[model samples]
Structures are given as structure tokens and as C-alpha cells.
Target: MIDLALNFAFVAVGLAQVLALVRLVRGPHVGDRILALDTMVINAIGLIVLVGVKWGTQMYFESAMIFAMLGFVSTVALARFVLRGDIIE
Candidate 1:
């Protein structure tokens, strides 16, 4: 039963990743695309966490944490660039 649940979660997250990629590609505006990219990052993080849970390992969780930090920083940088045309002084 647990394995079944994990498999279902993996499939759901994979589908979500594909849909987010579609949004990233077909978004009508730059901001929309950026948001879609962020969504994809979030979904990726969720997938990583699920893998960690499935495997009963610590490395996946650590990798997910690092990926999350990078995702957050990139999203903030992108939003700032869009708003101000510059990410740094």
C-alpha cells in the first residue's frame, strides 16, 4: 500500500512538472513565464522530497533543501530584474 501511494505521488508530481513546463513555454507574458518557472522549481522540490521519503535517505532531503534555496534566490532575482531591469547595482 505504501509503495502504491509513493508511485502515485511520483506520477502526479511528474504530470505537474510537465504542465508547469508547458506553462513556462506558452505563457503570454514574461512575468507569467517566470511564475511558471518558479512553480516548476517548487514541483521539483516536492518530487525530490517524495523520493527521499520513498528511499528513506537523508541525501535526497539535503539536495532538496539546497535546490529550494537556489530556486528561491533565482525567483527573487528574476522578479527584481523584471521590475527594475537590474538584479544588482
Candidate 2:
């Protein structure tokens, strides 16, 4: 069933997010931490989309888009920090 599939997808995404968080926490390097955080955000978006499909809501989808944009900005900021040792000059 579609509901069962959605549940499975949610569970999988949740597991991935947890692993990504752990990686972020345990990262020995700043770049590793940033990559893990980015992965977590991407997985979160997937989870949101799945939830939206299950609940039949358009708002969730829109929010997921916003989250994606925020994730991109965060990644850029983090990368700049890593490269320049400061987010802002």
C-alpha cells in the first residue's frame, strides 16, 4: 500500500538523518562535519516530501522547498567559513 511505502520511506530517512548527525558530531575535521550536516538537511527534505504525500498537504511540500533553500545557503556559508576562516569579511 501507498501508506506502508510512505512509512518505510520515513523510517529510512530518519535512520539516515540520525547517522548523518552522528557523523557530524564525531567528525574529526570541520569539512566532515559540514558534509554530514548537509546530508542531514537533504535527508530531512526527502522525509518532508514523503510526509506531505502521506498527509495530502501542499504546505509541507512548500516548506520542504524552503528548507532546501536554507540548506543550500547554510552549505555555502559553511564552505566559506572553512575556506576563509570566517563567514563574513
Candidate 3:
């Protein structure tokens, strides 16, 4: 049923987040850690969207969009810093 699917999705996303956290903590290189952090942000956005779908609300969608944008911007900034040692010129 739909409820069962939602529960499964929640569990799956939770597990993914946990794995990402572990990678973030144990990554041997800066790039690996950054990749893990980005993955965590993506997982969080998925959770937020799932919640919105379950509750039949639109507010969570807005927040999810904001989070996605912030995640992307931060990832780009971090990558820039790693490449050039400065986020902005």
C-alpha cells in the first residue's frame, strides 16, 4: 500500500543519510568528505519531499527547493575553494 511504500522510503533515506555521515567522518581525503556532505544534503532534500507528499502540504516543497539551492551553491563554493584556495576572486 501507499503507507507501506512511504515507510520503506523513509527507512531507505535514513540509512543513506547514516552511511553518508560515516563517509563524511572517515573520508581519507578532502574531496571524499565534500562528496559525502553533498550526498547528505541530497538525502535530506529527499526526506523533506517525502514528508511533504505524506502530509499533502506545499510548504515543505518550498523548503526543499531552498535547501537544494543552498546545497548546490555550497558544494560549488567548496569545490572552488579546493581548486583555487579561494571561493571568490
| Per-prediction TM-score | 0.95, 0.92, 0.97
How close is each model in CA RMSD to the real structure? Answer: 0.8, 1.1, 0.6
Per-residue lDDT tens digits for candidate 2, residues 4-82, read 8888898899999999999999998988999998999999999888878887889897789999999999999989987
lDDT of 1 by residue, 19-51 (tens): 999999998999999999999999999999998
Give the poorly placed runs of model 1, Cα more than 4 Å off. none
1-89, model 3: which lDDT tens digit per residue? 99899999999999999999999999989999999999999999999999998998998988999999999999999999999999889
Best model per lDDT: 3
- What TM-score does model 2 achieve against the real structure? 0.92
Candidate 1 structure lDDT: 0.93
Off by over 4 Å in 3: none
Candidate no. 1 TM-score: 0.95
lDDT of each: 0.93, 0.91, 0.96
| Model 3 local distance difference test score | 0.96
